[model samples]
Target chain A: MPKTAFQRVFPYLLVLPTFVFVALFTLYPVTRTVTDSLYKPARRAADPSVFVFLENYADLFDSTHYLGARFVQILGNTFAFTLATVVFSVPLAFLFALLLNRQLRGTGFLRFAIFYPALLPLIGAASIWAFFYSDTIGLFNTILRGFGLTGVNWLGDPNVVLYAIVLLNIWKQSSYCMIFYLAGLQNIPRDIYEAAQLDGAGWFYQLRYMTVPLLRRTTLFVVLITVTYSFQTVEQLQVLNQGNPADRGNLLLYFIFQSIGERRNWGYVNAMTVVLVLLLLAFTLTNFLLFERRDDDKA
Target chain B: MLQRSLRMLCLLLVASLLAVTPFVQAQAQVVVDFYYPTAVDGPITQTIQEYATKFEAMHPNIKINPVYTGSYTQTRDTIRTELAAQDVIVDVAVMLATDLTSFVEEETIVPAQQFIDRMENGEAFVANFFEAFLANCRDEEGTIWSVPFQRSTPILYYNADLFRAEGVEVPRNVNELIEVAQKLHTPERAGLLMPVAGGFPIWLYQSFAAGFGQPLIEADPAKVYFNSDASLAAVEFLTKLGMPTSEGGFGVGPMGGSVWGDTPTAFTSGQAAMIYHTTGSLTNILRNATFEVGVAFLPSGLPNENGEGYAAPTGGGNLYIFAATEPEVQEAAWLWVEFLASDEVQSDWGARTGYVAATRGAWEIDPLKTLVEEKPQYLVARNQLAHAYKEFDSYRSIDVQLIINNALSSIISGNVPLSQAKATLDAAQAQIDSLLAEYR
Candidate 1:
């Protein structure tokens, strides 16, 4: 049962380049971002890189920028955006995958149409939606005018804009999730469904039990990716609203971006980045370790 | 058949693009990565490539690789990211004039003054630039960090045909503007459209501030005078224009929906009679507008006791040379900047691109003069230059801008009270003061 030393070393050597690549890009950035939060520019330090820990984090939390309106609102917005997107996109994608899984005429064409939004550059898609939301000459307004109703400012009004982007984020991500679900559906053997039918289980019951449990792994993967995508919601926010109506659409990553690009507060930005990374890591781990493991424990 | 042809064409296009670059970059000793933004809406990237080609022919020793970065904001981010990642990259970049302070703080760009000093007629070359255009490009120490390249100003573009039909003259002041708007407003058409979007709200707001004879930011970039009596009157007056007639104000309504880009379309499509936008959009307006477009200075606030026109803000990008190991590279960047600024080049560039020439002398040049005759709108923008001052910029410029932008967005939405607007300014001033505290 003794393994040759070369066999063990060979596996490590084969994976060495990939490990280095991941470490350099992924692990290194995470560590650097964490360390960078500890540094602040000091007048006495000629280099402008002094290690003043936690100052950046403190400055960000205290209502610094928007008079008395702190980042508490922004974090709330990010959470709302993430939860709304994951909730709508995962179920909707599953619905789409179920619909398309049928051997029906025009299924191929329907799939293409459903997935079209995902193919366009997200910023460009945001622009198209902005035009639709535009008051004077937008499609929605034009339709509203035809209906004798006043037009809604979808991207400008604070109350409506968040939902506007939520609607858009769902549109953008549903198709992306659908592909994974479609693959998962395909992987589920047809005989399993046939056996369910033979057992007198209805389609609804089959879907709730056989199909849902079978696709747990796919749903987990989709949720993980979608949650990550939701946090990094910059492109559409910039295009449609630029995080406007008093930062109503301002998500966490967008705030981090503005901190770096707008404020040049490197230490503060890194602190926010570190916070976001930790939150995301915790989210990912909880999904996989807790909810994701429940099925295995049951098995 | 169509799909097959499209695929073939795509393959050929890709092949040709791959084939051409190696041949061009091969013979040059030094290749400059020149990144620029498409500030003006046009075939600007193609124009840049043509200019680069000419520069390459003139300087056989140097090859220029022009990268068309998307927008001014994107270009700034691209340079910042590239510099942060690569340390020393992008030999030269065209960035927002207001970005000089941040770029200097980041150490991504060197004082272009050094590059100017090493050139032939370098001193004269630096002096030839208009000082107003240089306002945002210099630090507090008066160090010139960038060369004015593509510059523009905010102005009022009116629907001349609509004005003629309504028998309305171009409004000279805020009171008169509302009077004219009263005559022009229809159930179907808005009397005016101006941008209050998060993108360039501050630029257009400057035109209003100047009307009240106050600059938003004092010459000292650190000091902001936003809550002054004049500023309150100016913004409240603007708010009144968009306030519904039912609200004891003009019926234009908050127009919170009309973004800067949408403003131009509103005027062009004849949905709105007047619009406030950048002169950078003049050519695009002219090309697309069906009606005869009239160009005029933004409506001034109550003229000062001396009766001066409302001040406009100079806006656009300037070229900055980042420090690199090779002196030759910096030298090449200097030459390129000079070429871009030269009267012969800028005069034609201004005319073709609708950007104002950076140098006063360029206005006298034949290319610009001839274009002025062809399109009098060019002269109107140039004439406004005298009233135009530098854009309000300061250290931590982006942070200050975002604070102001959010405030403007809030005010224009009509939900926030004017007092909230004042409070927003107060908070922004505090934040900006704190941002500069580090430098101290």
Candidate 2:
């Protein structure tokens, strides 16, 4: 009844490759970045590298300094961008999913049309949008001027720039979220809707009662994906904003990218990264608690 | 059967080893990996490849690999990453001339002077480049760090059709600029477009500083004068471009400022009567415009003692050799650099790409001469070189650039009141001083 050597070692061998890769790529970099966050690079050839533990973090939030002002503004911009994108895109995606879920003529073509924006590279989409948003001689401006109205600066006004970018993000991302919602929709038993209809439930009632409750887990999953995506996108910002109009569009990831790419301020950026990771971790923990409690209640 | 299979495997392995021997022998030919950046609109990568092919045909023992890294900043980032990881992918690269300080600080580059010293006509080679173009290629102690290649200056591109219709003469100085712009201003068309709204405004802003008789930096990399009297005058003039005359402003461009990529398009379409853009964009704008385009020096804020009022900041990339590569590879890379900066190649590159040819000799050559004769606007940028100063560069240049950019943006974009302009600049100067304090 004793196990053979091959049998005993088979499971460990199976997990080893993945473990090795994770350790090398993910664990190693995370450790290195955390360590790097604590140390300032030597600014001069004669100077030694100095460890200033939490000072890097403090420098980011000290309002008397320029970095502090930038950090606060960028952090606010990132959060607002994330909140706006999620709030708008999720409902729009759900609507699209609901529409596409119904059996209709030309639904396949319509679905593809709706999903086409998601297929274009974000950078390409941002470039195309840049032409549309140009303050002078743009599509919107030309149309506005044709009607004898003043054309608004979509990308130039700090008040309107974030919303302009958010609109693009929604246009690009809603269809991607729609794909998930469509898949989630397909899994729901059709008979539930049919039964609700038999009980004289209206379309709104059916969606609110049967569909919404059934898709809680899917909605949760979609929210998590969208939130992560909102935090990570730097392409649109790079192409469309470049922190222009007085750096109003500067966001967390773009700030970090500028820090690393332009300034080579590794220590400061790493501290920023640590703060970002902590924020994301908080969100994930909240989601876990909610989902875990829901599952326990179901059981 | 097992014995027969084992013998077959051994035979295959030996055959593979024999196959690899010739591949290893191909290493006798030095392969130089050249990475260059394209900041302008054109088929730059294709042209570089064509040059590489020609270079290789001439020297069969050497191979050239031309890589098109994105922007100057992106190219620097890529190279920095390679150096940090000790991967050493690039043998030679085209980076911003202003990047000399940072690269030298990193000690990742071999000074171009060393290579020139070994050449037969080293002094003649150094003398070939315009003094203005060479400004960014030297350090505080005057060691040449890079060879100027795709060099440029910010010049004024005006809609000549609009100027003629409005009875506006070409602006020579600040007063003329204001007069011409105010006359040309209309509800439908902006009078001026200063493309100083984006991530790196310091390049264009430096032109303003120069016009006001205060170049941002000179021989000293540790020192910068962001809040000097001349710099303050420059900021005041810039801020006024977005304000109304009733408010003691020029009433020209938008208060929020204009985008870099959008400026050329706007000027061509007649949305703006004039624009300040890089000479690198000359070809694209000239080709696209339906109306006659007038190229002029950036209007001066104040004339110097010599009565030379015009001022611009020289820009664009320089070719540098990496120190990490093998000696033979470095030698090959130097040969490739020499070929690229040669008069014939410089002429072709400038004529095709609209860059001001780096060497004076290139300007006197065939295609460049032919192009200048056909479109005299091509000569305005080169003429402006007399008044051009070094682009803003200092220790920790990237950070310094961003600080100056933000400070300028805050002032010019009206985020901060004009009254606070000095304070903003002072703060930025203080920040840069602390950042560069160690170097001093």
Task: Point to the candidate with the largest DockQ.
Answer: 2
What lDDT does candidate 2 reach at residue B90?
A: 100
lDDT of each residue in A1-299, candidate 2, tens digit only: 99999999999999999999999999999998899889887754335558999999999998655567588988998899899989999999999999999899999999999999989999999999988888876788888989999777787777778888889989988989999999999999889878888999998898898888888888888889889899887999888878766678778988888888543487898889988888888998999898968899989
RMSD of each: 6.7, 3.7
Which regions of candidate 1 fall more than 4 Å away from where they truly are? A1-5, A42-48, A65-70, A191-199, B1-33, B56-65, B81-86, B103-128, B138-143, B303-309, B323-328, B438-440
Ten residues in a row with the worst lDDT in model 1 chain B?
B301-310
**For residues B1-440, could you state the per-residue lDDT of candidate 1 as single tens digits?**
99999999999999999999898677656878898988666688888888888888899887788988888877878776765565656889888888876767767677977866667787687677777787887887888899898998888888999899878888887777787877888867888876775465778777777677678876676677666666666667666666677776677633463666777888888988887888888888998999999999777777432347567889888998886536788788777877888897788788888888988778888888887878889888777766777888876788778777776667766657665777755666576676567555
Q: Compared with the real two-chain complex, what DockQ does model 1 have?
A: 0.33
By summed lDDT, which 10 consecutive residues of candidate 2 chain A come out lowest?
A40-49
Please report how far candidate 1 places residue A93 from its true position, in Å. Answer: 2.5
Docking class of 1: acceptable
TM-score of chain B of each: 0.88, 0.93
Q: Chain A of candidate 2 scores what in TM-score? A: 0.95
After superposition, the stretches of candidate 2 with alpha carbons farther than 4 Å from their true spots are A44-48, A262-264, B1-27, B303-306
TM-score against truth, every candidate = 0.89, 0.94
lDDT minimum window of 10 residues, candidate 1 chain A: A40-49
